[model samples]
Target: MGPRNMAQGSSQKPEFFVNPEFITTKTRAIADRKRENTPVPRFTALVPRGHTVPVLNKNTLVESPDGSYRDGPSTHGTDRFERRRADIVAAAIPVLNDQGFKGMRLTAVAELIGLRATGVTYYFPRKEELAVACIESGFAVLDGLVAEAEREPDAGARITQLIALFTARDAAVRQGEAVPLASFSAIRSLEGEHRDRAVEGYKAMFRRVRALLESPELAAMDQTDRTIRAIILLEQLFWAASWLCDFDIEDYPRLAARMADIVLNGVAPGAIADPIPSLTAPARPLASRDESKESFLKAATRQINEHGYRGASVDRISASLNLTKGAFYHHNEAKDDLVAACFRRSFTIMRETQIEARALAAPEACRLAATVEALIRFQLGPEGPLLRTSVLSSMPVEHKTEILGHSYRISRQFASMVVDAITDGSARAVDPMVAGAMVHAAINIAADARPLAMAQAPDIVARFVRPIFAGFLAA
Candidate 1:
């Protein structure tokens, strides 16, 4: 369910992992360019040898849609089709890594087999279906790694084995051989049964890690903190794919060993983590303080976006606006109320965005595209901080449920637009629910800005919607 999934591969693939110096240089280049308001420079990561790259070649001996060998006579299309399906999913893993779920194009997969987009759909029917298959496969691979790691007799050895699993995946990413699940955010793009299944898949993975952490050895730690520690370790492992690009691929084993040591024993033996610092608001002009609620909400939104809900202190929110804690109490009963209020304000803006999209006097397809574009622009703009929905998971269950209801309503509206487009022949026949979820997902992708590079807002939005409307292979 993570936006990206892994492929089943041995942990012995040798490749030159991206060195830290390369990443630092790229980061500095991007920062300097952003400071000058210049477009960010884009570069392609090297794809690992043997990982198929999509290229159109008619002479290539590729499997046909019905599982026939296009170059010669073959068996009936039953088992071959399933194998082909697996191949398509494998091909897509790299695309998902490069472009994400929203930015991924089915055509890329088709090109891997020298087929058209329609040919790919003959099997998947809908893009979401393909995504599910890839995600399931990826998670299954991860599950296997966890199961393997569990077999190790020593707890530290077990942890090292698990770290090695991810380290291998990280190298694959550097060489573009696989996708890292850490960057996977497309889980929120699923709806109804798909969403339920995906969420459960995520929970299962989390539970596996939690179980590993809860192994009798760490019994002295608080259960809640143990869970947090498990989450933190997993997060660090997930993101290691990104950071590992800067280190020699050969160092992965050493890196995994060191990581295992750090996780099992603090960097400083017997040391405890320090408290997270709070965000303080900068000096605001007198005009801003008059609307205390608005000012506080803005400050809180920024803080929460950066540090998460639990980290965003109510005390800090009040201080950011140069107001006392009493000023916060006067405007809101508690931090929960403030968070709820923030969710309301964020979703309201989102709903208004859809409303504005619908109000436009244009074809349904155009309207849908416009609405998505508007939402993306809004998410990346100053209001972007408010759109961080990660905080909702930390909210009281009732509050989370209420806010989710509002979120789903908006998603359904997007789905409705997709249904309209398909009905009018502006889009191919796709599951409206999945299409809607994808649109929602794409907006979030824009917020993340992973695949967007230096494109203008309009261009970025257009590219984001292209695969959704025109199929990935559309010319």
Candidate 2:
């Protein structure tokens, strides 16, 4: 089916109908008010008055005295239909972020807004449609931030401004003034035209961010350098939301400044020569002794990385390995078991690499650099592409918590290394915790760099890992 048709309900097709009175008296007035006061752009596009598409003004749904959102008089009188739809979108954002598209349930979203499954289906017939809407809203929010950042005089200033704006918006979300941003990692689980639209939107946002590095001062960098840096910056921003909860909301601005400092100037000391170590040895094999189970996990990890946890069905995993369903069950008890195993395998590989890198006779900074380079190389290698951390969203709460505990321990290990680097005078006096988290984020995101040819591992490490150690603007 086509993109538009895929979004329609089986019994009734969605119509682009909105009441004119609501547009003039409510939506336009709010838009005008927001335009006059807010320097940053609003979340979604507001179609002109009398347009066929309904006005989706998230600002109009105000919180009542009881803390629940109550529709305005115009919404009750004229645009109840559209208002209800907007409410569903707002409620679904957090659910989608937590559960991913595969785990997101229409009934769960319905419960949040006190609507039946049928009620939500009336607005968004298919869950994919609702998911697409959530993803689009996320893109709109990011586009607004990028637009605000573009006003800065240079790339460094723009990057700093971007982080500041993100933290401010995040603070607003915490204060209940805005909706939570949707997670884009699960976009891979979407199929057909829905996936196409989401991917296009993401690429558009990526292009805008990549353009930030196009200033005359940064003109010496090639497109490949810019692309790697842009992805690092964007991934770090996305990853920030996951860990920002550790600090009080009041510390957001301070955290943003520190994060920007790390991104712009990096963690290396000014007098340090060659932040990256010359590690010519090949990465040690990350596979387990059980070749049969290892084969299953390798295929499963690749599938999960590409199609998400839910989309990576037992059938798909079996077929990828030229094995039958019986074979899958013979080795694994259930799909969740497989997913948990993948997470364990990934964690083991990371910890082993860290241990090996630390054992090197090299300086602390070189050990950290070697660790990151080895991980990136493994990501592009044959045994490669570790399970993405995004899969944690699709997992059950208990499983997710356990996995997160493992992840935290690994991150703490990295933090210790950074502390050592600082003490040894090889790294700058950056927050070891923040720097470690950033390093963890970068390594986790390296699995997404599968398109980079294995032959270019050295250049990829230079362009990607070097930037993380030394600043993004480093020659």
Best by lDDT: 2
Alpha carbon lDDT at 275, candidate 2 = 55
Q: How good is model 1 by TM-score?
A: 0.45
* lDDT (10s digit) by residue, model 2, range 164-271: 777766665554445666788778899998898788778877888899888999878888888888888988898887788898887787888889999988877342
Error of 1 at 317 (Å): 21
Misplaced by over 4 Å in model 2 are 1-79, 269-288, 452-458
- lDDT by residue (242-275, candidate 1, tens digit) is 3355478777766666555445542221111221
Give the TM-scores of the predictions, in the order they appear: 0.45, 0.82
**Model 1 alpha-carbon drift over 4 Å, by segment:** 1-77, 172-183, 269-475
Candidate number achieving the greatest TM-score relative to the actual structure: 2
Show the lowest summed lDDT stretch of 10 residues, model 1. Answer: 270-279
